[model samples]
Target: MTHSERWCWYSLLLMLIWLPIPLGSHRMWSWSIFEIWISCQTLLLSASLWHQFPWQKIRKFVWLLAPLSLFQCWIAIQAIPLPVEVLSIIAPDVAQVYRQVGADVGSLSYDRYATLTGLMKGIAYTLFAFNAVVLIHSVKRVKTVLYALVISGTFQSFYGVLTVLLNSHQSWFFGLPQGHRATGTFLYFNHFANYLVMCLCLGIGLIVSQLHQTESGSWHVRIRRWFSAVMSAKMMIRLCLIVMVIALIMTRSRMGNAVFFSVIACGGVIALCFYKRRPRALTALIISMMIIDTFLVGTLFGIDKVKQRIEATSIETETRDQAVQWSLDIIRDYPLTGTGLGSFYSTFPHYTHYNIGYYNYAHNDYVQFAAEAGIPAVVLLSLPILVALWFCFNVIRTRHSKTLKGTALGCLMGILAMMAQISVDFHLQAPANAVTFILILVLSGCVRQIQVRPESHPVAVDHLLLKN
Candidate 1:
């Protein structure tokens, strides 16, 4: 690797180490550390890789997502109106308090919590822009970074499982607290579960790719050896996957459970379709995943509150339904330009008398984005996934490397899974999820480029190539 590539790899390792720090501790210095590292990396790239920035190539992709960012910025400055019909229903005393608070604090009284969260979201978007630039400029460095992410992510899975088994509740040096929730570094169990799901997807990709390579060997003897390795890796990956699923169930997060299984199923179908040449094997893989998932769900969680929570989809609770309705009203009032970046709660009482203390966000990412940034922001934010899907389709169709092919499919499936989850919960709103999403997008982009690039020279494949 070149000097720049080496530096990038080291920087990524640091990021992985920083990722699990709890957000509430004095030692929670990972955020600033990563910010500094990324800033420096950006400077280095600007100075050395100026000519190879791939601006034209990546501009198309960036432009697809830029409108959302700009729209969010625009909405962050506007004031949204609450519907008169809804406002009429508020009790006189509550209405008086709402008006007084609104008039006194303006933005502060309305969205005290969102002030910090909105700023964080802005920072995340900036980081995402930087990540995109880095990804387009240096494919090799991006690949190395992604590989490091996979390794660290696997370790995190193990850590999460251990945390569950030990039932530990101590806070980590990074300020992350352990509790009944499965929060690693993030304070919220839901956010932690989302992060785990993404990492699990990456692990699945790595394991499957390895198995395929081992199975497709040259001679009968080699094929036998490859098959053995493939089986072993597959078993190990399944074990890890089971642990991850159990963790998700334990989180008691309805959205997380739904997303977890949905991704696995969607990913299997996609894999089967891509491997149409081996229809029987593909079918068997799908069946096996279904069977394993069903058995694991029954065995690990049993039939109880956790299982019930996972199965319960409708807003059965009145409070939750009210919150959802209030969110809808906010979106309707600010259809084009939202109240402000973090002003949803501030503006919510004007729509309904639902107690604001119980709610922080809309509990839905798309609604949150629309309510905070407006419709345009929502569209802009969704561009990456659409572009990624198109890119994955092309890569899967044209790529020769089985590893690349599986990765393309896996990344696509993972993104889709996360998107499905986002429809019900605001996982992407948190730093942990944002960080993981950006990493996945960067990795997917790199994999696509590697697969499509012309092969004029001989390839030097890794010795740790995927067997199967």
Candidate 2:
């Protein structure tokens, strides 16, 4: 690799390592700074290497998203109140802290928590887009980027296991004010678990690819030699998967568990559908068995917690309802340009008389987006997902290379899982969650490229011929 490639890889590695640092009040600020710096450096390196932007296939995608990101930034700066502001205008007593803060229109409210989160989200999106542009230029660079992700994920899995084992409860280190919740290196456990899930999926893909490569070379005299190595590697990966699964479970996050199981089921179905060409009936049977075993294990060892979670679904429902109500109120009042970004919390309390003390976010990503950046932002945000789904469907229909097919299916599953989770949780708003989402986007892009690139056909054919 060139020095630029090495630097990109190392920088990604550093960001991953820093992901779980428990940075407290400085978490958002610190991550924003790191992302901006890395993105700028990547842009410089990319410009030097290619002398122009690369990957014109998705230029439309980039252009479509830029306005929404810029609008988010504009909203954050304006911090306007929605029609809900009228409640505070009339009653004043019903207004929450944020509305009260915004009521003083003469001066901007720089003290609100939402302000900080909004700023972070804007910066994070900008950095993510820049890095994504850099990644699109070279397939090799994309692989290195994925390697960095895998390394980071492995680190997160290890850290999560250790945190659980040690029962570490402190929020942040040094003099930073501790967050009130268990965030690990973020502001919440669910966000951390979301990051882990993204890593887990990528790690699984890497391990599968490695196994496939090893097996393809061992049909003759070297069969036993390669078989042992492959089995050993598979065993190690299985152990790691177990650790990640356990950590995800221990998080007690319903959305996390839901997304995790959804990915597993979806991935398995896609694998059986497209890749299992031999003993097809047996493949179906085995897949059924695996799903049953997964459920059985969860029931036997994870029953009580599962029951508790089921019961707690009511709480989640209530929270989501209130957020939806607040979002609708904001949208109804300002249908064209709802409350500016970072202004939801500042505007939410005016619509509801009940006390929702200390809750800064809408808890549902769609609702948050609609409320913060208006309906236009929500439409733009869904573009990548829509494109990814289209690509995934094409891959399945074509039954392309097993690796590309599997990776595409995995990315599709990941996106579905995340979308399902977002209905009840604002996973996209948190830095860790946002980062994971960006990684998934890149993975989807890579899978799409693999399917379309002319070079990939020969590469797969060569491997198959060599195996035969």
Candidate 3:
């Protein structure tokens, strides 16, 4: 890697390290510790670009970013001031309701301040993703980032477990929410669980790749080699994996746990099918891991609590259904532009017929995106995800580098789990969870970039080393 690329990786490494702490410098959950890190790293990354802007570096992944760019730009557009007459067509629901009440719906965003906040967050997300794609230029760099992510996740998981063990709900950390549930450094347990889910995917992929042969045939040497592998890297990673799973179970989040194990099952199946060697061993390992972890270890960590939550969900009022209806109501009025980005917090109340306290998020990412940015936002947001997943499907189907293929498989599972969880919770609203999502996407892109190269390219590394 070039010196600039090296620096980019360093900046990225530090950014991921600092992202999980509960330091909210800005109130919107938009400007937090993670955001601050993103800003600093973006500056460093941009400086590298100013010296040598590697257009060629990003060209392969450039087309993939079109929907995201449009999505971000459209968010900024929502903040611009327009006459209420113009808005009647753009944000009909907010305007019609205001007209019915003989109140003026401001020409700017439905709530200009909120939209301004959303705009900042949208821009930050874009810059952050851009930096990731540019800086993480190789498979090795991607692996290093994943390793850092696992370590960071392990630290967060450990802290969460400790908090739950101590039962520290009395004092909120940094005035952020803390409770019996292990929230880690995030404001909510669900967000923490989602973050851990990504870590679990990476750990599983790494572990799966490790179940292979070594050539030294002496019995003592082979035993030592296996012992060293178990004692050093693989065992440590598996230990972290166990910690995260326990923390996740302690979270008592029904969808979070369900989505995670489901992803694991599916990812494992794909890995088995794609991986030509040791299919039996891989299948056995995955099944044993699931049975031992979910049914065995998880029961010790309150799996019944998760089961109760799942059961209780069926009895509760379909609140998200109502939220979706109201969101649709918003879309009908402003079919073109909707209520404006981040306006859901302020706009949803006016349309709500049921008594609910502060529906800040629709609790459904898709509904919230449509409510805030209009139906087009859904297409804009989903196109990139769909395209990325298509690439991942190809990667998982094709036989290639085990490390890269495993990385792609893990990322695919991570994205699927997030999607499943978001049906009931807004995991992506948290900067920590959102950053993890972007990181996965970036890794998939890098894996694809390398996979497309001719076989003449350097042989794929058997191990993930940071300093190659």
Please write out the lDDT profile of model 3 over residues 140-235, one tens digit for every residue.
Answer: 676787789889888888888888898776434575446778877777778888888988887777666555523433555446556767778878
Alpha-carbon lDDT, every model? 0.59, 0.58, 0.73
Q: Please state every model's RMSD to the true fold in angstroms.
A: 6.5, 6.1, 4.5
Off by over 4 Å in 2: 20-26, 50-52, 55-120, 136-144, 169-184, 210-226, 229-232, 274-303, 315-320, 450-468
Number of clashes found in candidate 3: 2
Preferred candidate (lDDT higher): 1 or 2: 1
Give the residue spans of candidate 1 off by over 4 A. 1-5, 24-36, 63-65, 68-120, 132-146, 172-178, 213-223, 226-239, 275-285, 301-305, 311-318, 451-468
Residue 392 of model 3: what lDDT? Answer: 76
**What is the overall TM-score of model 2 with all chains considered together?**
0.75
By lDDT, the best candidate is: 3
lDDT of 2: 0.58
